[model samples]
Target: MMNKGIDREIDWRLRVFESLSYPTIILLPDRTIIAVNGRYLEKMGVEEEEIIGRSCREVNLRNYPEQKFPCAEQGECPLARAVHTRSGQSVLLKYHDVYGGEGWEERVFSPILGADGEVDFIIESIRDVTRVKNLEKMYSGVRELIDQVVQTSVSGIIAADRQGRIILMNRAAEELFGYSGYDIDNVNIEDYYPPGVAREIMRKLRSEEIGEKGKLPITRVTIRRKDGAEVPAEMTAVIIYEDGREAATAGIFNDLRDKLEVERQLKEAHAQLIQSEKLASLGRLAAGVAHEINNPLTGILLYASMMREKLEKDHPLEQNLRYIIEDTQRCQEIVKNLLAYSRQSNPTRQYFQLNEALGESLRLVRDQKLFLHVKVVEDAPAAPVLVNADKNQLCQVVINLIINAVDAMDGNGTLTLRTYEDRPNRKAILEVSDTGGGIPAENMSKIFDPFFSTKEVGKGTGLGLSMAYGIMEENHGRIYVKDTSPEGTTFALELPLVPMSDVILFDSIG
Candidate 1:
């Protein structure tokens, strides 16, 4: 009963198969077209009645003079081998169509076996995979091009996972970090950066605190080299993702040793120029001192003018008296300003309050109407921020910065003055910020250079800030511009704080 049921199922399968539209062709064990559906007969350009009893040679393979059917006789074909060995197999074969002479076809032959383990029939299915094959070829070519590019790049490229293990290191990376590509793969990235710097960076990365796109987090750091020397470098990192998951981070580093040396040399050159200007101004003031001596002698001339007006009625010395008075007053004013500009004049060094110094400087410029249209804001802590600096020199620095701020604003804008303590190193800081046309990029490097002024001719000698910088340096302090943008510029001065013991001694000496 089971045998009968199996036979019945097989007969039903053959009946259902003939109803399909695909070109289904069944080949007999003798390599003859024993059965075919309507689609097969249409594809092969043969009548169903004529092809059922015909051998495979009549429909095709007639050109093979050596084998009756090249597929079966050669026994090398996948379908042929499967039939001979009574094992199932699949193989791709190319053939020309008789009706469509210009087209070629790829056919898949699947061999089937009987219960006796002999070849029963073969089912062939065909498809055109030409477009898919072309796409595969294009992808392979692109991969080859990318491989060539990476091999020849000059910049070092390194990628690491969230765990800090390196996944990729190019040839340049091998030379830069002093490790071969093979040695770095799977190694921790911490071995490159200075101790603790790597951990800090990783913490920021985990917290998403790094700079956003269109910006860079340029942190100067020291990286360990293969020879054990730490190299100064500016590092930049970028995050990468794959399939919506964080995959790794890529880092690129540039050497800063040469750039730093160049900046140092420029600073030295600028310092020398300032020192020369200071000496030159001293010489000019010395010549003016000789002329100033005539001021006291001119007082005698004024008394003679009065006597002449009282006793010498015939002389009429009124015009001479007027000339003497005018020249003497001019000499006195010159002598006063000359003393102020001369650095040789010893300014009293004291623990002066920053707010007092700012008040003094503002008072000097306040009488002028230049600041009328401008808003001057002062933001400082209430605590006394005292420093050991020459009182006049400190006032001068503040005055120069304030005047420059006014000039930059070009008549109407905001100016800010602030003071605070640099607690870490025991320093007091004063900052002057202004809203105005900012300095140009090219002139920024030369802003502190003596006589390098951008102001209109006769409006500036550019010696004010240069002098300010020199005075700050002499007091064991430093001054610099923090930033400049379209909005404005900010100048900052940091001076070391004087302890209470020194302040008392200074006041006693005074």
Candidate 2:
């Protein structure tokens, strides 16, 4: 009965060995295959009679020559290694099975110790791991593709960790920020935004008012550049999550300098079209007025000259006669201005204090009827802001801007004139701001156009800004809308600066 139980147990062990999915072989210490499972016999397409008692190394070399590692070329395999180390060993190999299928295989060799702790036998098992290996390769390729796409994108992409530390920045971001890889190492992400901007962005990102929570949609914002300039940009940002918790944040930015410039040009072009139409209609009126006034003005000039010549020197009537001639000439000048709505007059260039010209412009209209209810505030530094430009034309531009500001306010508002010295760019900026309703969006495009005006027929000629634009261009200067809102509008005029070293020292010589 004991012998019968022993035979039953052996049969059960053989059945379990055959049930393994992986190919299995039992080998002796000398690399000889002593026993083989049914799985191995089936995979090798050979009967157990052929592989049993055969050498494991010889069978692998003859049927599975593609098996690699364990220095098989040197007559050593994982089976031999397992016996020598008294432990398990593994090797990866590519193989062709009996059914003509090809894939990756993990060959493992586990030593079976005897009662004396000596490796008496080894078990060789081959596990097909092609699916796992293929998955890893696919994952690697995907990661590489994502990295390439980010680096080559036109929009600037930046990512940061939960600690607000900058962790990644793409090539476009580097170019936009004017920073290098080594330059921004260990830099905090908050350093890129202006004061309180990062906090506000985070707050909005978490709030549902502006956009979906954890996502800030595309919107305009200001970023602080490496050179200390506040640049306009459009940005979209999102919070990264891991396991339902915030992990990091990423932002995509688009520079708006070029876009804003294109819009401004389009507006200017439209404004010019409207201005031209009005100038054409009103130019005919100016011509008619000049023609009708010239004959009468010439007659008065001739009679006044004769009367002044006949009168004695230092006589009271002589002075009155000279006044008539002078006043007539001033009237003639006024007529010339009427016809000069579209004229481009030459300017005399010289070095002058920009602040002085601004002051002069303010003084010329300080006591005027329109200025009675207007408050003028000058915000220029005490130091002279010198510029090389046409002094008269510069003052004319300032005066025109002031008049526009006053009119925009309907004769009752604060007019602030501010000046700034931009020595780095060698520019002098003068801004005229007024507390009034902002210019209409539709009218903004027509402001610089000929004949464009918001005023009534007789109140304006629609040529003030057109003439101002032409004068600015002639003087190598620029004029632009500095800032505007429902509460106010500011127009800025920029001119080239005259360095102190080049300033004439007439005062010192005298």
Candidate 3:
């Protein structure tokens, strides 16, 4: 018989167990179900009386009928382990219902001790863990997919902590920075940016005006490579947060070197097209003006010469006739130059050596008074660089460029003429560089425009460059200012090169 206090203690423990939310059961040493809580009855889909006197294995099989061995006999059975160790044992097990649906449960078997510290009964508890397992599996799959995308991306991908320490960088990022994975490990992100740029970027990312809601707008920046070269890149960045706190930043960037080069080429081509149209309009106007002025100027020169011969040297009107003759001759020269600017004569092309033509032009200009104080440097190749172009027109272009360079230097600076062959482009390049004050920025675009002169009034007709430009176009060549800076200026003339074999064949035919 039990004491009243001991019986009440037992009754109170039974009540607590009955009130628990998890499925619980009490088993005798024989492994028979002696007590079952309401939760256990509901979980097993059975009545309390139906499970109370049943063997534990029989009751468990009511819910999971697919077991090939009894639960108490299986090696991994929680109850069997608990019985052998005289302690608690827990395991994850698959349970199946009558409809063949599967579920996961954590089954725990804990021994209940008697007054003499011997195992009398065992308490079994079952907790469902199916939803948690499913969620873990889904999260793992998503993480793996995101990693794959980042690794295979064409644009550079970088991730850094809030303190700007590099945590992750993709292969494309390594290629862009010219650094390998081992080199950038744990390095500060500022090491890859131009000085102070990383700090400024972080400041902007934290500001609402530039970055809001953790997202930054796409922008362009210059980043430094490991080779100490700078590259332009377009980048977009975003802040990553963990549990409502700022965590890290991620950026995606694309190298802009190729894109910028294409844009520059397009701009140059467009500018050339516009200049060509303007020159065409000016050429038509020049042709018309030259024709209209030629007849009147010719008649003025004829009548002035006739009157001058009739008048004696001592005649008072002789001096005035001389003046008229000189003025007429000046007008005729202007008309002739205008016709040349209009390209009234077609070029007769032939294969000629560029170095020979440059030498002759230099010889002619070196003796002129304007070049007396200027030093000319020739950097021509030892071998002849042959081009299929009009020799006279090319020489004339060379002389005009030299004169202009000399004038720019005020006849007291160095003028360098260089000739070389660009085999890949099949062209011969002639460069004229002067150590003079560079062309003004505002005047650069109009340098090839007809009648657009930077010289003083009456000093230039502004047709020299326009005429050179026309002659080059007719010969399938190009003339352009290569560079201009405060230090000096360089003009380049490119003409199509002819192979020596072709030149020999043409000479034999002639």
User: Cα deviation in Å at residue 22, candidate 2?
Assistant: 1.2
**TM-scores for candidates 1 onward, in order:** 0.44, 0.65, 0.76
lDDT value for candidate 1?
0.72
lDDT string for model 2 (188-248, tens) is 7878989899999999988899868999999899998888788899999999999999999
Q: lDDT order of candidates, best first?
A: 3, 2, 1
Instruction: Give the Cα-based TM-score of candidate 1 against the true structure.
Output: 0.44
Local error of candidate 1 at residue 464 (angstroms): 3.4
lDDT of model number 2: 0.84
Cα lDDT tens digits, model 1, 411-509, are 689999999888888988899999998889998767766567988997776667766766776677878878899999999998887666777887798
RMSD, candidate 2, Å? 8.2
Please give the lDDT score for candidate 3.
0.87
TM accuracy, model 3: 0.76
| Candidate number with greatest lDDT | 3
**lDDT on C-alpha atoms for all candidate structures:** 0.72, 0.84, 0.87
Residue 497 in model 1: lDDT? 73
Model 2 segments beyond 4 Å from truth?
1-12, 65-70, 73-76, 96-102, 165-168, 177-185, 224-230, 264-284, 307-323, 340-510
Q: For candidate 3, which ten residues in a row score worst on lDDT? A: 67-76
lDDT of 3 by residue, 1-510 (tens): 469889999899989998988999989878888888899888878888888888877776666666443355545666767877899988777666567776677878899888988888899998998787678778989988998999899999999997887888999999998878898664689988999998888888888886586777889999999888999999999889999888999999899999999999999899889988988888889899999999988898999899999988899999999999998899888888888788898899877799988998887777768877888888988888999888888888999899899889989999999999999989899999999999999998899988899889998888889889989999999999999998889999999888899888888999
